[model samples]
Target: MASNDPDREEEAAAAGEDEDTGAQVAPIVTLSEVAVTTGEEEEDALLDLKAKLYRFDKEGNQWKERGTGSVKLLKHRETGKVRLLMRQVKTLKICANHLVLPSVKIQEHAGNDKSCVWHASDFADGELKEEMFCIRFGSVENCKKFMETVEGIAESSEKNEEKESKDASDAAGLLDKLSVHESKTEKAPEEVPAAAVKADDETEK
Candidate 1:
């Protein structure tokens, strides 16, 4: 025989409610926030622009569509090394090898001023070569914006590299100067004996 106590039934129901509340999940994270975080962690991009990628056909002397992609100007947070990332839309493929912001150059087409050419070296062939890529904007203003953004990133990257090189050179120069000073200090006693001998000879004369 079991006694069905009202208080006991209420207590069991309350425990079940408590368990359900405890199992309730936290709110889901948004995709945009995740993307921003990933971008910051991976590249710390200075410039990110959407553009249609084209490869210049040397034989036909015309530009062909590679895909629509985003060009990102990124810098290594630790090394300060600049790199360009061409990431295709709806694809996991990314072109990031031997990419330098300084190597990126933009120019207007000879026949059509509205059409712009974005050129950069693709060293995936393991050789020194220039690979041309064209990006056309809907309006002249958009074209200018793209050009200015790329150019600005390139110029800033060049300056940063130059400054780093100069700093390294200066540090090397300082080390060399310190080494020379140490060597001179170590030889000072040898020179003193020579000077003393010369003084003694002069005194005897």
Candidate 2:
């Protein structure tokens, strides 16, 4: 058993050597993962679907592809307001951001069953601009769903606006009545008291 090869034994000993020196190397710079906010925190997504978005270029007179990603209809929890949001697929960059106002109109794009068009005052690019937008879905059902959801939100927003207007009008009317009553009350003091009038007559007698 002692008749072993020296080279083999040396190689085995080398292989058995612990390569870790037990000294840890510290990183030159440490980076901690920071949380990113998408500004959608206070909203709840009502509808989310995979879709492609487009914008009509007035100068070119043709629709331009915006992005392909998930489009969402987000409703605020407290305000009950809804907005349409679409971000680029990989980048997660917002391509469309606009509120679903009462004036919004979404219709099926001409000759496209799986697509719908709408107009919105978009603020995604940091400036408010009146934009004509079109969105296409993989299925006709998704397209219909997007359109229906948007239009329903618009209708609800319109009703809320109308109700707010009526309430404001009623408040104004009540305030006007109170103001008129105050004016009458102020002028009522100008009329002489009956007892004062009688005392003046007696003094004159």
Candidate 3:
């Protein structure tokens, strides 16, 4: 009976170990990696700063808050085009998106040193619309930096456009000259002599 008791105790210990098993189970679903793309992939970020933006609602007759997020100036790598983009902080939703054109005006908002106002043809809503926007920065320096960078990009864009126009005009003029020279140098088709034509006609008759 004493030997049987020891064997029973050993059996209970083995069952306790099996009940508290530490095994890892495999997951039922396997996930594959997917590539994510943002439209700004082809563009290089020039400036990134945190700011709060507002837009004037003509219908409401008051200023409406657009978003508080990181505003960016993105320049295209190939085309040298610059655009201003701002997204909401929490939701990461775009609030403002427009090109930095020379014709658009950016000025200090009222007497605020940390804020600036600008007019743009915004496309954040997936359509172009004229919008008046004012952005306030946490510091005066950031406000100035954003304004200066925008102005510089605008001037550069204008110059690039002018240079492209001049280059296209020069190319067109060169093509026209080539066409005229070709016309002048081309030989006229050979005409049969009157005597030869008359002899052929007489032989046919």
Candidate 4:
């Protein structure tokens, strides 16, 4: 017969290995710690952010951000275009419920004929009140292209939202109609038996 031993030694060894692995892993991060900025000066910072966000996942480190980072201007840079420097500001450890990107509003610069413009309105920084903080330092082609890309994404999102809302409303209406129909069906009068009616009629005659 084969041995039914518990393999105590092997189990202990495996438990020890698990403890060591856990120690090697870094601690979980809080949401406040993640930040999105206009420009990140070092690649290391970006790497660190990614590690904190995706550590729970099994995938090897990806260069992409766990949150959304959009680049919207006129275009990707023509002959003399300069890219905008953007960064993220995090406040707490990221969880499935919380989005990777912060919720901030931003606007582009408004100039008669200027490229490479930065608009304070494009950013969510509340203290900067004046419109002058915006700038345009990119080429018109690049700015237009960037804006179009962002607009496309926004349009798609809006469409999805609209569709979802419409579906929900339709479902609710159908349910209401069904409920009404069911109530009417249940309240309907029952038919009298023909034999009972005939017997009563003969008795009366």
What C-alpha lDDT values do all the predictions have? 0.70, 0.92, 0.94, 0.39
Runs with alpha carbons beyond 4 Å of true place in candidate 1: 1-41, 95-98, 111-114, 123-129, 187-205
The sequence of per-residue lDDT tens digits that candidate 3 reaches over residues 81-199 is 89999999999899999999887788999889999998999999999999999999999999999999998998888898899999999999999999999999999999999999999
Winner of 1 and 4 under TM-score: 1
- State the lDDT at 20 in candidate 3: 50
Candidate 1 minimal-lDDT segment of 10 residues: 31-40
- Model 4, 52-130: lDDT tens digits are 1111122543322333223222222222222222333353322112101111122444443332222222223323232
Predictions ranked by lDDT, top down?
3, 2, 1, 4
Query: Which digits, one per residue and each the tens of the lDDT, describe model 2 over residues 1-205?
Result: 6648999988878887956678889999999999988899999999999999999999999989999999999999998899999999999988999999999999999999999998889998999999999988999998888888888999999999999999999999999999999988775446777999999999999
Report the C-alpha displacement of residue 22, candidate 1, in angstroms: 32
Alpha-carbon RMSD to native, per candidate: 11.7, 5.1, 7.2, 21.4
The full ranking of all candidates by TM-score, starting with the best, is 2, 3, 1, 4
What shift in Å separates residue 20 of candidate 4 from its native position after superposition? Answer: 35
The per-prediction tally of clashing pairs is 0, 0, 0, 49
Pairs that collide in candidate 2 are none
Q: Please, what's the RMSD in Å of model 2?
A: 5.1
- In Å, residue 128's CA in model 2 sits off its true spot by 0.3
Q: Highest lDDT among the candidates is held by which one?
A: 3
The superposed Cα distance between candidate 3 and the true structure at residue 62, in angstroms, equals 1.6
